[model samples]
Target chain A: MTETPVKVLVVDDAATVRLYHTSLLSEAGFAVEEAANGLEAVEAALTTAFDLFVVDVNMPKMNGYTCVETLRSETVGTPAPVLMISTEDRPGDAERAYAAGANLYMVKPVSAERLVRVARMLTAGRGIPA
Target chain B: MGLVRRNTPPPEETAAPPSADTLLSQLDDPDPELRREAALGLDGSAEAVAPLLDRVAGETEAAVRDAMLTTLAAHDTAQVAEGLAVHLASDDAGLRTAVAETLATMPNSVPALLPRLIDDDDHDVRVMTAMVLADLPHPEAMTWLAVMIREDPHPNVVTAAIDALLPSIGPEHHELLRGAVERFPDDPFLRFTVEAAVK
Candidate 1:
């Protein structure tokens, strides 16, 4: 039997931003899933098998920070790495993501190359979704 | 501490001939564009990965680093896989796109290494993931794509999956595709693709 590709869930409010990041990460050899809002991202995470997560901080419905926080509260034992993508340049943004249980935080507009590199790093040793 | 020869990059080092390693030596050149050009041009060459890996940490300019990432994309050499992995983590869109193209063509570390990209948060990365997975046709990819077409909000990703389906999709997925096309008439690509597939 053939194995499954790792699944990444991307959460963002903008259609274009979601498309761009998804295309870049997918091109770089990733299997991508998209959520238009933070609530959608959270729902998907709870049900689907995801290797990694790339979320936006300022999405409609549930924001990325809240989504990650919710996931941390509900995942019970294993917590997948959360790579938060945001436009806020403040130094505290990183702190906020960490507080919300995000493993990493990136500022937008992050390049396609940089996003791929980070995905590989976070998912490198982890138990990726099949 | 010692006076290093400025003109030449040393005999033993230049053996690979014409690449980023040699180009990196010129990054310090007075010309800004030359530095940028060299950084971009050295990508993916066997000689460039080592030094580029080091320089990536220190280089601050987005323009120059972007060039370096392009150069890195040219690298399919196994010698640079580790560093290439590092670039894969980068947040730069251009570099990620380059790496995706590069990964699609090259022999990656393992079939196992391909999955991480599929589930990436970036949409381009996901679309590219379909392409790279086509190179190997992992089963998990088909499942992920199938779900995306069903649940994802964007039509582009759905279209990408339809394009990737026949080549990378395994035999067990026929039923899934059939149901999918039946459910979503909006997807013309899948409609045509499924028609072609049955043929």
Candidate 2:
């Protein structure tokens, strides 16, 4: 049987941001989900198993850090691989996200091409784990 | 540490037409930093670990995988979760302890994880495990703490054992610290901590 595409969850407080991230990954053939904020993202992570999740640090309900914290703490769920997106461009922000368990922190204004290249590289050759 | 400046973009990329999954496909670009950055990017996200692991497993680069693993280890992804289980079983004492310590952070994993440190083959693991458990206020764990104080071979273990005991020690455990002081008389850290405990 042919395999299904890998799924990704895009999370941010901003609808525009979610759509943009979803576009980058979806065109690359990844199935995509969206959450308006970190809390909804955590809820989505709890119920569905996505291959990757991109989160923003600043949000009303829960921030990116809190979202990662929740995923790590809740054991029964499939933990989404966390990529932190933030505009907090301070030096320590990336370090803080890493410390809080973000896999990678990307500063804002990244090009769409770079996003596609990065997603393609990460999901390559990783078949669904049984 | 203001190394970079940025703008607030839309939280998600909803504005763009959906793109293909070729985000990191150009990993072969000439820049080694690209490979390194690709490794970083591939970490933690489900879409990221498999390729990074392949890069680590196949590519000759020694350093690339560490960054990837660090990122993978941060999230409790399915791959990372399995890796955590294997790491707990690792024979290397320090690595086992470190893995246990990391796994201990998640409350959902407390049952499977807490016992590893208690019965850990390494003294450091045992001591650290005891320290972690002291907060739970388990009496049985305290008994193991006392036993380790009375028995571990390392001088630092003796002191660490004493330090672990300090959190919840009672009158019955006084003899254990006293005995450790005698066993590790040359260890000033132990001697001081024990002397303080018994007095």
Candidate 3:
């Protein structure tokens, strides 16, 4: 029997970034979906049982930190692994992402190889074939 | 007694509009609703810009902040744009996004400010400025994007400029986009983004 592909949601305000990330992950054999901002990401999380979330910081209406916090909050509690990506490389950016409950934080311009590798590693326990 | 209609106007209708000073004081009120009303009431008051900006820097309530932003945006002055631009460095992502949105609405006031913001030492600030340029309706937006795509040192900032340029891509931009791909020859993402834009 074939195993269902691991589901991933990639959220970003930039259409080009969303396309770039989605294209890379989809080609890497993961099922990928898209959201424009934190609010949309939260709304999608409320219904979908995604195995992973790839979110961006500095989105309108909502932001990555707040989105991760809400995902981990009691309202829409989901323990899915989150990978927060941003252009911000400040001293506290990673700590803030972790404090908001992200499993990992990466700066922008993440290479395709590293993104796919991280996604696979984070979801390895979910039985996704490497 | 026979039914009779009172001829006097209602007290609410006769009340004087709140003074700018009263509204300014209410910006610090305990009730958010009152603060929001105060912000709304201060719209277009030149003297209120400083205080309104002060409140915006510390205003935690989204509703009040939004009202304040709207009021501040109505001024559409360089001073207002500069005031809002300072928040782009905020740790609060939401505030940065809000400030960007507000800045996008003040095209007439932003041209003088755009170059400085795009050239900021912080890459994140530059990226946010690129994001604003993407949505800014001014005709010079494309020109600014081209400069950023060509000159900015950061790949993320250049990619953001490319994103802003994609919708309006033309023959003139093809070479520039290709140059960006060549500039960052090792960056697959920038190459992919430029390919997607030019093709």
Candidate 4:
């Protein structure tokens, strides 16, 4: 039997960053979809069943914290793990991410190896294909 | 010295839904959630847009301002165009990026609203405006790119304009492209952008 690749959504307002993340995840055999901001991300999440969400913090229409909250809220109510990545490393940033329902919080320029490893670790035993 | 603790009753707060008037007033509230809720409350009415644009100009909170923008984006009214123009020069990069995305979605509104932003004091606004214009088939896009390449002070804006102009730059505009190259000879990135575009 063939295995379905784990579906992931990569959301960011920056075109360059979105492309970079999408390429990295796509190259690693994960299905990737891109959203320009949290508004679009929420819209996509409502329609599509993604296994994971890689979200950026500061965006135009909706920021990351609100987006994650909505994902956890009854509006979408998807329990899929969310990984919040942003340039913001200020006090309480990680706490805010956790409060908003993100499973992991990472800063920008995260090492490629670390990103893939953490992604695999978090999704392991969640019934996704190896 | 005696330390005294006085018991005080909690102040009574009303739970009534805010009226339209109250909502508009709350658009400037110190709390972003309050401002966002206020904007959402006012979003369905066409009459509320004028006040919404006013709030958009001074609203410092991103979520609140984005709420206002989302409301504004739903309509294609002249008021919306004006609102977009007002935010084109915003110091907030995120807000400006949002405005650019909104403008890109409404390509018909671009020609009339975007030119003014090309000359904006903020170079990021110019770059973003140019990038939005690049995506469309509008004739004004070429003219604006030429103007930006010739006069825009920032190399980034000029480089973006050059990138936008590449798809259609023909023999007639070659000199104009060369002029940009000559104008910013010291900027390797700008020169490289022009050279790549011309090639």
TM-score of each: 0.39, 0.38, 0.93, 0.48
Task: Tell me how large the interface RMSD of candidate 3 is.
Answer: 1.0
Better of 3 and 4 by DockQ: 3
- Where does candidate 4 clash, by residue pair? none
Write model 3 residue lDDT over B1-199, tens digit each, in one string. Answer: 9989989876664778899999999999999999999999998899999999887979989879989999999899999999899899888777888899899888899889987998999999999998889888899999999999999999999998898788999888888998988889988889988888877
Answer with 1 or 4, whichever has the higher TM-score: 4
* Between candidates 2 and 3, the lDDT winner: 3
Residue B23, candidate 3: alpha-carbon lDDT:
94
Write the residue-wise lDDT of candidate 2 on A1-130 in tens digits: 6677788888865444666678667776788899977779877877788777787765544657767777777452454567777544555767878777767788654567776666666566644321
2 or 4: which has the higher DockQ?
Answer: 4
Candidate order (TM-score):
3, 4, 1, 2
What are the per-residue Cα lDDT tens digits for candidate 2 across B23-93? Answer: 25634545666666666665445666555544433433334434544555556444554455454433332
Models ranked on lDDT: 3, 4, 1, 2
Regions more than 4 Å wrong, model 2: A75-79, A127-130, B1-199
For model 1, how does the per-residue alpha-carbon lDDT over B8-106 read when each residue is reduced to its tens digit?
556674454545555778776667687787877665456667777677545656467657656654564554444554454444433443444445555
Q: Which candidate leads in TM-score?
A: 3
Which of the two candidates, 1 or 3, achieves a greater DockQ against the reference? 3
* TM-score of candidate 2 relative to the true fold: 0.38
The DockQ-derived docking category for candidate 4 is: incorrect
Candidate 4 stretches with Cα past 4 Å from truth are A127-129, B1-199
- Pick by lDDT: 2 or 4, better one: 4
Candidate 1 chain B worst ten-residue window by lDDT? B92-101
Those runs of model 3 whose alpha carbons end farther than 4 Å from true positions after fitting are: B1-15
| Candidate 4 chain B: worst-modelled 10 consecutive residues by lDDT | B87-96
